[model samples]
Target: MPVELDPVKSAQKRSDYNGIYRLEDLTRLSEAVLSDSGQVDVMLKCTYDEQKLPVMLINAVTDVDVTCERCGQPMPLHIELAATFTPKTMRLEEDLVPSNYAIVEVNDYGLVDLRALIEDELMLEIPLVPKHEVENCAIKEQDMVWGELDKAAYEKPSNPFDVLKSLKNPK
Candidate 1:
């Protein structure tokens, strides 16, 4: 279910409300934006303050099937994310920033697209270097070969001065 925020009521000091959201709604969001193979499950408790600031206290567990970066094998990943999202009306200066974090805006009526918000949060939680932990993974040999090739490509050449010295020494 979507959350509705009444800005007028919020501005009048009628804030501090809570609600329970479901996991199926989050899955639908993943289906719309993510690949069909991707899956997400989430539950969140949302709170609003008198300033119309929405704070989402989220606890989520997800299993996503994605191509592994290290081994080229299909990897199934499990992730648990617990975080809070705060909606702000104004952007703070860089010097005064609390921390480096993402900020989303609340609409005039304080209505937020929970689907989109959760989807984005899940995307951010994905690992940059995905890999499988199982031993003897199908692509392990292939990955080793690729690693050797990469090492060769980046290896430093022997110093020309050193080469000349070696030649002079006949060693």
Candidate 2:
């Protein structure tokens, strides 16, 4: 079934959900202007831990088209994310969150928009610097020569700080 969940109630029931959603339907993802039409497959479960903390687990996979930073070409990337979230009835201090899980707020209405949550996670998964594999990239020539000093300049270059040092130290 779909993943629309009331986090609190779902946790009580220890329910499991599975669904597929079109990538285009996630408006935030469209902001990147991705080139491909894809679908996100999601698996969700709501349960409690040994401490009876309300927890939600999500596993999702999808393909996304992103621009390669080096070549400026669209590349298809496969993304899979698995994470766990803890929902609190009352706002808790950040320090109270355990190391292994994330805290998601349960709004006053008690509805958790799983779609938006997944979208947020997907956004975070995008690479800060997306690039194709080095072998596949077209920038080999530019990369090789990017920092090379001009071999044609045979003359020794004058020191830029020589005049300043001479003025200050009078040596």
Could you tell me every candidate's TM-score relative to the true structure? 0.55, 0.79
Tens digit of per-residue lDDT, candidate 1, span 1-171: 345443333434534433434434556534433245534455555555344444555666667666677667667666677776565545533343235334556686555665667666766777777767647466655446533455667889878799778888983
lDDT of 2 by residue, 20-128 (tens): 8788788887677465378889999899877677889999998888888888988878888899998766655567667889888666787777888898998888898
Q: After superposition, how far is residue 53 of candidate 1 from its true place, in Å?
A: 6.3
Name the best candidate (by TM-score).
2
Q: What is the alpha-carbon lDDT of model 1 when measured against the actual structure? A: 0.56
Candidate 2: stretches off by over 4 Å: 1-4, 91-96, 141-171
Error of 2 at 81 (Å): 0.9
Candidate 2: the clashing residue pairs are: none
Where's the lowest-lDDT run of ten residues in candidate 2?
141-150
- Ten contiguous residues minimizing lDDT sum, candidate 1: 92-101
Q: Local distance difference test, per candidate?
A: 0.56, 0.81
